[model samples]
Target: MMKIAVIGTGYVGLSTGVCLAEIGHHVTCIDIDINKINLLQLGNSPIYEPGMEQLLTKNIENGKLLFSTTHKEGLQGVEVIILAVGTPQGENGAADLTILQQAAKDIADYLHNNPIIVIKSTVPVGTNDSIKEMLEDHCKKEILIVSNPEFLRQGSAIYDTMNPDRIIIGSYKKEASEKIQKMYSPLNAPVLITSVRSAEMIKYASNAFLANKISYINFIANLCEQVGANVDEVSMGIGKDKRIGNAFLQAGIGYGGSCFPKDVKALLHTSLQFGLNASLLEETIAINDSQQELLVVKALQRFGSLNEKKVALLGLAFKPETDDMREAPSIKIAKQLTKMGAEVAAYDPAAIDNAKKILGDIISYTQSIKDAIKNADAIFIVTEWKEIKNIELSSVLKEAKLPIIFDGRNCLNKTKIMECDSIEYYSIGRPAIIKK
Candidate 1:
């Protein structure tokens, strides 16, 4: 088993380290946050991901997983160092490399043993090469750099990592490529070895394309509403074709979470930097921005104004099964509701604490779906959490003051809503059931 050191203890780093250790590798995950390191040492995951804490506790008990705040301590005797630091969006939508640059500098101090530097962070094209240059310049030795970008969903990161569709290893050196291949050999997934730049581009290209699919479907969803065509049926019809997979065909309040939004903007920034026409990406982002506000527009159109109306929002996190609220559509929706003088009460099985930080006391936080919707004039389904999706319409009609609902994610069944004659149901790209 290989000894590996992973920098940063965020979602990507922690998930990668835990899964690697699960596959029988000795892994030390280092983070600058002392609290995160301490919590991890006690077998607690700082982030919420399915089956992460179990694997983390298991690996730690098996002596396969480790955590530290210092790079020197974590880097000692490690054969591979995976850089999974955050590259948040900076000015003009380009990826900010300040944190990554600092990590490289810190890693350079402990590179006495030649270790393969694997970049598991999602970066722009040619970033791996630039990092290689920086590391070599700092250490004054030739270092092998491998661009091994991660393709993890926020909610199912552990499953995605362990059961990856394909592992793309990008490195010029045959030794570096083979070493990364050997590291992940236990997974038995298909491996694609390519140039570093191409590998870096692959990550952005893949995420942007998924974002494009989301925007494309949302674009069609808007048309379906105008033409009285059901988006669900249209999505299913188009998705049946093998060439057009049904992955991101769900027409919702645009694509959110950490990956799709940032990657699309970063790629658009890259295209503009190279003097290329990227109007499609531009429009993709434009469609998403408008989609986020679609529910609010509907609410305003329905009530004429949201002056002190008690509006209950179901689901605050970007998606289900995770507490990640970065770039979540609920943020915009909450702010708009509050601005329009709506008393917003939001409920999420997870992400309430995180949402409170961003939302503050502007809106009330509810413990359950029933608590959020009780006595509300209107209800808006933001995230399609199972808890929110399984909410009984009978209870809603009994509890709500207005029994009017706007589903942003299309979580409820239209057929069920049609069966109920007293309730009003509105959803994205679907005909509204306004039988009150």
Candidate 2:
């Protein structure tokens, strides 16, 4: 088994380190956060991901996984170093690589042998080269840098890592590429080796394209509503054509979480630096940003004004099975609804703690769906969690006073929802069922 060090303990690092260990690699995850390292020492995960903590606990018990608070501890005796530090968005929309740069310098100081440095974090193009140049001044040996961008989803990151769509290894040297290729050989997936720049661009391009599809479908859904057409049917009809496969075609409040929003903005920033006007990418972001307010517009039309209206928000996290609220539509909607003098009762099974940090003292937190919907005039469906989707409309109507339901994710069954005469159902790209 190859010895490796993953330098970061966020969603990307923890998941990567644990998965590599599960695949028979001896991995030591390094982070600057002592609290995070202590939590990992106790076989616990700081982030929410399906099947993540279990794998972490199992791998730790099997002596395959290790955690540390410094690179000096984790990098020693390791042959491969995967840089997975945070590249948070800056004020000007560019990816702030302060943490990544710090990690690279630290690795250079702590390296015991010449090793392959894999860029697993989502970064701007040419960041791999930048890291190499920075490392060269500090290290005496020839350092091999590989742009191995990870494409794991937030909720199912473990499953996605274990079963990746494609494994990309971007390296300048042939020896570096082959060595990195052999490292991931056990995955047995389709591996693509290319230049460093292409690999870095691939991550941004892929996220931008996925975000484009969501915006495209949402725009179509809005048109469908205006023209009395169904977007679900349209998506199904078009998806049958192999050229336009129906992934990310769900008509909703738009894409959010860590990847799409950050990557799109970072790419736009990069384009601006080169004097390239990326009009399509700019419009894609505009469409998504506007989707957050569409539900409020629908509510405004139905109620005239949201003055002291009790509103129930079914989901707080951006999506289901994840507690990540970064750029979540629910936060925007909650703030908007509250600004309009509406009382919002927000609830999410997993993200309540994280949501509490953002929506503190603004919206009331609810423990159950019944509590959230109790005496509510309007209910806004945000995330399509199984618990929220399985909520009975009739039961909800009993607790709600007026029972005007705004289905943001189209989570509920329309047929069953329509049968409830006491409830009013409104969803994106679908015909509204108004209770007369």
Candidate 3:
């Protein structure tokens, strides 16, 4: 029954606020955007997360959750303030703490008494200590700074939050850590208490390592294609080992989203600041950059020349089930196709509107995947949606002009695609299928 104020209503903020309320805590979500606030006040979600809107609506009806644009109004009697603001990557690849700093200053100016301030944003190793100093200098009150970095994946944020594997709390004060841990005690998840700096490092270290895993498998997949080995088989064979485990090993159009790319870059920047170099991370980024170009090359090789060619892209979001396209490889591939004088028609189950904002006039929008692929010279499966994966290649090829498939996500049955006349199929880390 602790009162919590979650500042900033972006994906992390909104999800955290509503979920907390659902767990029986009285929650207030504060945001600067009046339009977003207005929408939330009506029990509507500005972002598309599975089950978030419904939970938010239920909580609002039950008087457990509220939304506002004013921080003072939300913070008046709140016991804990969670900073969930954006920490976008800056010019030098470090996390830009502009939003976080502003939120801290605002919280300082509005607080009537000392309240525990927890930073849930992914920040550098020592950011919590600095936040404490900044708040104390401004407010002249004892503000407990705790680092409780979020580990929610975009598409499965709700499930991940409710059933987290572990929760890490970083604080100098043992009592502050205990208080936060008590709030989450009902979940029955294991809680790790550690130094503030170690907790911050855990977030970046986890993301950077995942990014490396993806890049590692992608590189192996590329070599498999050249050596006539199946990447799927290779991935399975290696992933069976318990030590390696089987996640983030899928060969696709590279990793993209709000977290992995930015965090990896920020970690590299941190290393550079200490006069150290991260050669592995540097290569991971290089391999990912080259992997996208390889897909384009495979498509062009099959089609001869892309000039005046019509191409259909099946998925536009970075990954499936979320509308975030922060660093989607689809944009790069689509733009490359357009630059080669190919007319690109794209469709996604969600994220078309957001994609249109970034890639306006460069690609045509289609109502459905079938419509997008109609009369197209080539088709690229960029995102691995379950619906897209389940599509019958026999039916889709009948509608396509050239029947050429470049599977960035390896979402097609190679044998079935090759069975069709005039069909050519190419996929990552696998043998290309060319029909005579």
Model 1, range 241-334, lDDT digits (tens) per residue? 9999899999999878888988999999999999999999999999999999999999998999998999999999999999989999999999
Q: Per-residue lDDT tens digits of candidate 2, residues 1-436?
A: 7999999989889888999999999999999899989999998889999998899999999999999986787788888999998899999999999999998988888765888899998999989998998888788667799999999899999999899999999999999999888888888989999999999999999999999999999999999999999999999998888998988899999989999999999999999999998999999999999998999999999999998999999999999999999999999999999999999998899999999898898999989999999999999999999988999877887899887899999889977876876678899999998775
lDDT of 3 at 163: 88
Candidate 1 lDDT score at position 318: 94
Query: In terms of TM-score, how similar is model 3 to the real structure?
Result: 0.97
Model 2 compared with the native: what TM-score? 0.99
Model 2: residues with Cα > 4 Å off, grouped in runs:
none
lDDT of 1: 0.93
Model 2: weakest 10-residue lDDT segment is 414-423
Clash pairs of candidate 2? none
Q: Which stretches of candidate 1 lie over 4 Å from their true place?
A: none
Q: Per-prediction TM-score, please?
A: 0.98, 0.99, 0.97
Global lDDT of each candidate: 0.93, 0.92, 0.89
Please rank every candidate by lDDT, starting with the best.
1, 2, 3
